[model samples]
Target: MTELDSTAFELLGSTGPFAELVSGFNVREPQLRMAAAVEQAIDAREQLVVEAGTGTGKTYAYLVPVLHSGKRAILSTGTRHLQDQLFHSDLPRVCEALGVQPKLALLKGRSNYLCLHRLQLTLEEGRFARRRQAAEVQAINDWSGRTRTGDVSELSDVPEDAPVWPRVTSTADNCLGSDCPSYRDCFVLKARRRAQEAEVVVVNHHLLSADMALKEEGFGELLPGAEVVVIDEAHQLPETAAQFFGLSLGSRQLQQLARDAKAEHLREAGDMQNLPDSADALDKAAADLRLAFGQGNRRLPWKDIRHKPEVESALADLRSVLEQLRTWLETAAPRGKGLEGCWHRAEQLAHKLARVCAEADGEYVQWLETYTRSFAIHLTPLNVAGIFQQQLARLPATWVFTSATLAVGQDFHHFTGQLGLHEPHTLQLESPFDFQSNSLLYVPPALPEPNSPSYTGAVMDHAEHLIEASGGRAFLLFTSHRALQAAADRLQESEYPVLVQGQMPKRELLRRFRELGNAVLLGTSSFWEGVDVRGEALSLVLIDKLPFAAPGDPVVQARIDRLREAGGNPFMEFQVPGAVITLKQGVGRLIRDAADRGVLVLCDPRLLNKPYGRVFRRSLPPMPLTRELREVEAFFAAGMTDKGEQARA
Candidate 1:
């Protein structure tokens, strides 16, 4: 091996810095292999995709290589939370262990940093939806006086989801750029400067995609000199890329514009009631459009409802008022920076609304999603391969995309194809944990087809048995909210503590579950991935069915139609591969640590009955598979016995 390769192996070896400095460290062959692959890719300036399974320590694998290379690198994670953790927690430890002080910076989107201009506007207005919001604003004002970073995350007094955040934080659409009165003290610009100067930069996928979008989010700054780009949790990029590449106009944006217009009107031209009047008119039109959407949250093709009289009328009225608002803002644009920003936002939103409201061009799926009080129209591209590939071509960085769940059945075709990656080197590393001994995959016998009317009841029956076997430390994952709610209601009277999703925010639910120790969490999509609960706190995962993308969803349907037009099997080529990846995520929730033992109960009959199920079966970790409830019972019984013996000893 080369000296550099030997150096990497020795660093993460059994007697390496991590093993000596970091407590509870275990060197794994998979981690070492993955790290070597990353190092080679970085040296060769190659595109590499690695599925370093859970427990493979993929984070340190790539970090050691990047730190060793001493090259400018951009490390992108899945979410802002992960980005923070890597910067504040993981990166520091690794750097300390390696005895290398790399210049690092953490950069998030503009909304994360408090905008002094918006805060000044909000303080002057003193308008709030509730009394609590006023208090939150006051708290923010107090904290703003001393925060060096001006990141809203620094203020713990106000909840992250507080309504006041939107009022204070700037978005790309509303930011006044260099014209703002607070431009000199802009936290976003300061953060970007740090990132631009740093040798190592940590960011989330949203910002990465936004950067790729280039002009859309005002990002394309820090990536110019990046010699290596490591995308941790790379599975999320395709969907995030789709969002960034798409055209969207939301109710929140329009309402925020209306509110900002009113705020700017009072500041700029109080005598001209026309601007405020148009803003109010636009609010009314937006409300009417939302009301016309009629009830439960749904996403459907815009063409499906475009012809309905109420929808058609409400949409036309909304468009008219939005255009009128843009015109009024044009007259008011010379007044102030805020008014000018509002004018630009209005013009952009109006143009986007008109384009998305128009007929599809066969390349995009024109869809509308309605919420309880708001709605959004999106024109998402059927494929993002060309756009993604073009962006990568512009960058001279070596790319590494690693995730616990990227490949399906030992191939990167499903993932690499989505991004038009050309001849990328790929690696599939099985989890280093001894899953064959520590975990069991149990598929209950005689379950009906997932579409059967009695399927949910049957699944709940199986859930009851599994939750009992694992003694309440289980996650009852369902494919739909309907099934989730049904399971929650049924478990209401059970002896075990039942924590349901949407009962509270996701973070709170997880915190409570970890605290409760034996609580059963019934959740849907969000809970399927990125959750880590080791030890006995989480010992069972019961999936109601294989998670398939909703065939009825506008984007899915559009893609299906497109594939059919091209004479491809959408089910095998698209749906099944996607489902396999998702199922891997859910299954991955169990057996997080080597010492941990758990049961994975996939309550779907399709695994055994369908021909394509082999793909999912092959893709999962090599756990002992079973079909009998007795075996599951015995697994837990053995765990209890071992604990008893350990305590006694």
Candidate 2:
């Protein structure tokens, strides 16, 4: 390599496209330090952990170095939205200004693409004809002809929650891979091939997890081996890794098998007498479980049923029925091709059910839940750290994880320990924005305790007060659906327009919220992070609680027990750190740009009552603090006037 290529970053020296990008853009010291550190790390080929604060421009800090290095790299973001932004907006703009010619590809998982073969089968066999209307099929038919990417996102007219997509889509279990007749025109395979040759590939955490799991199964490589992998939103890694590692068998899987069997039986016009009998038995068991769960209104751990005869009886009956169905399917397997396929699917599902029945090992926790109208049995690992460590030990790539909230109070112990990454070179970069002048932390006084009977009402009142103070540009975040609904219902009674979570599709809601520029949105998980609303449009954020995982949650309980076994205090080790990281994400939503002004109202009084409150408080952005409610109103009022004057000028 030439000298220019060897030290191009140094020779370019602080005044190229990157510097120009920040010329009138107000380059803060912390962002520049992060950019330089990223450059050094790229040259050294070492692992690094960076906690880039809100408004740190961390995207550019790493992108500049990655682009300059001119090596094949993979950028894995936490969400599909960020993956889209990086591939379509950030990379193109930066590469154009720097005159870098690096091919890039946006690669999603198999499910995200349209499977033409599956689409043809669904239409030809009339499998989903009953669930979908004629107009919907016509819309999809029109879409299939014009789509190059085959991403469902292209069909903006179709709601994401629509049922039509699932019927025509393919899952890993059913995908025939290269055996399919349309392999030459397969969208997913084509995308993977392009990604293999591209210099930079943008993918989400789920896709990365898929690749990791696939590698373990001795499958062909799903992703190219890159010299470096940059992971954004690193805080979500532990929870997502746990999901990909654990196992679960839902009622939907059983229902899908039955439906598939019916479809096949109809297609071949074969006798499905025994198959329907097994399907009916499975359906009846599912209904009985649902009814029993409804009548009990109890959330019991797997072990708690030892004393309750009724609970034990119900579980025993369910298991017996499932085993009987499995036996019937096995007997019918040798009769015909249609029967064999159904039997195979049933057997695969039954293995998981049998594991649930056996309560296989202490590493797994068994629990039953009834939500909306359906019930499910979940078997989540007590600890994913052991599995994650094993997986990482098997890999040889240089992994670079970056997020705005990985480190808590300038320490990496909270995040790095959970992911089982020890002694990695850690870096903390503060937000580029001047938080002292641009942001205010509001902790309202005279509010009811979080556990008090009237807590939700008090929180709604405080939320209303804060939103009114900020002229209705606010996000009221809650830790529970009950709290979200309470806030939304109360807000709707008032003057401000309320954009609740399910009122509309997320994309359309966000778009309308931004367009309205002065609406209050009430949401839970999805709204806690990855939301960017800059300037005066979003001037307040009200968090209903500390965002601790619910106590009844099986996964949370399992993780807590695991922490205790390690001689660590579960409250301090698991709960406190998790809340702190999530609180950071919620508050981070307020101030997106340097010039933005907002008030972050944390309604939880436990933040002040408990000793661990200090940990949560100190992890927040370094905004000017205020306990007096009037101070918040005055600050936002003045901010509004100043913004108005600037707009007029």
Candidate 3:
């Protein structure tokens, strides 16, 4: 390995050229130390795990090194928001600061790009069922004529979860590849080509996993030639990797195949034969299978599903129709632009169904979820460590995994062990922010336990006091939707504007919260992490409970059982550390910048009562602790007075 050059190392320091080129660049020792570690990892071709706290400027720390290394690298983040920040914002500024321009590409999953063929088909078939749907389709069609990248993100007017998106965008199962009518101008293909040739590629964890698993077509492997792979929000990689490694077959996939088959038949003007009837039968069988789940949405283990006669009958019927459809598609030998894609989808779906129904393996936990209109069979691995280790072995690239929440009390074992990395170089950098004065960890005394019947009301009562003290600039984060709804109900008549999670999209809700400057936003899991709200707009973050996976969840139960069977302490080894990391993420949301000041309210008494409470305390930032609501009110009042003084000055 080549020795690290002083020139590259010097650039990270406060007096370096970076500081001169970038405006308002602060000289943070942690950021410089992290940058050095990243550079060394790349030069030595070894794995590195880093935990850089909230104000460490971890992004620029790693970006400077990766860009300076001049190596083909893949930078994967956990969310598209971060991906965009890196690709569109941070990368450009850092590259300019370094006076080097590297070829860069931002690639997302296939579904993020527009498929011209699918759009044309949707338009030709007049598939819009509502006025809004038609308008959305028309908007996309109009945008398609001018979008240079064809990224769905360009259509900010369209909601991310719009029903028309799936119809207009193509998935792996439905894409026709070179056989596509729009092959010459395919947005996904163009993006892939750019990524294959770029010096740096920015992608989300899911896309990176798909490429690592070789699940995506057209691109045989996404990271083969890259020299360094830096994963931001690396904590999410293990779960995302497990999801990609596992097999899932949803009713929607089957229905989409049937729809595509019918479309192909119509486009080809081919003999219908029994193709249409088979498609109808498959659709009906899928509907029957959904009905067999009875009512409401729930996930159940194979044991529970096996004993239900209705579910069993519906599964048998669905399996029969899928097999019949696959055979018909195979025998028909339909010659058309899209028929082959449909046939391939049918074959793959049939095989997946067979695999999902087979006897569960010891390493995997097989379960099924019944949604309102669709059902899916899932086979999630009990542990992803082994699978991830094998993938690492396959790709001999320098690996760097960094996240703010990867370590608990200065230990990276919980994070590294999940990814099968035994002893990679490890670094823990505390946030440079003066948390001792800027933040307060407030735990009100005499609160009801999280599981108590009166817990929600109690939490609301406390939260209302905190919000009122902070002048309604707070985030009321709940562990469950039930608690969130209950809190929303209790706070409905408050003087402050209440923004619930489902009332609008997450981004919109955040925008409103920031704009209102004194609104309370109630949300669940999605808001726990990857949410960035800085300044006086968010002064208090109230967590109703410790963020622990519900023990009743089939997957969680299976994992606990597996841990027990292996003779490990499930509570200490799995549950406590996991919850600690989650709590850390929730707390990290409050202090984003050096000037940001906020009060974090952890309503869960477990932090003070449980034997493992110390673990949670040690994992959080070193902030002053308080138990008195009056202290919280005093802190806010002091903060307001400070602001007033600054304004007068």
Per-candidate local distance difference test: 0.91, 0.74, 0.87
Across 130-249, the per-residue lDDT of candidate 2 in tens digits comes to 545546666777899999888887787766667777666666655556656677888887787778778888888887776665443211353435766788998888777765666666
Candidate 3 global TM-score: 0.97
* Model 1 clash number: 0
> TM-score for every candidate vs. truth?
0.98, 0.90, 0.97
Ordered by lDDT, highest first, the candidates read 1, 3, 2
Clashes of 3: 0
Q: Which ten-residue region of model 2 has the weakest summed lDDT?
A: 215-224
Can you list the residue pairs that collide in candidate 1?
none
Which is superior by TM-score, 1 or 3? Answer: 1
Worst lDDT run of 10 residues, candidate 1, spans 1-10
Q: Is candidate 1 or candidate 3 better by lDDT?
A: 1
Give the Cα error of residue 574 in candidate 1, in Å.
0.5
Off by over 4 Å in 3: 1-8, 217-219
Alpha carbon deviation, residue 533, candidate 2 (Å): 1.4
Instruction: State candidate 2's TM-score.
Output: 0.90
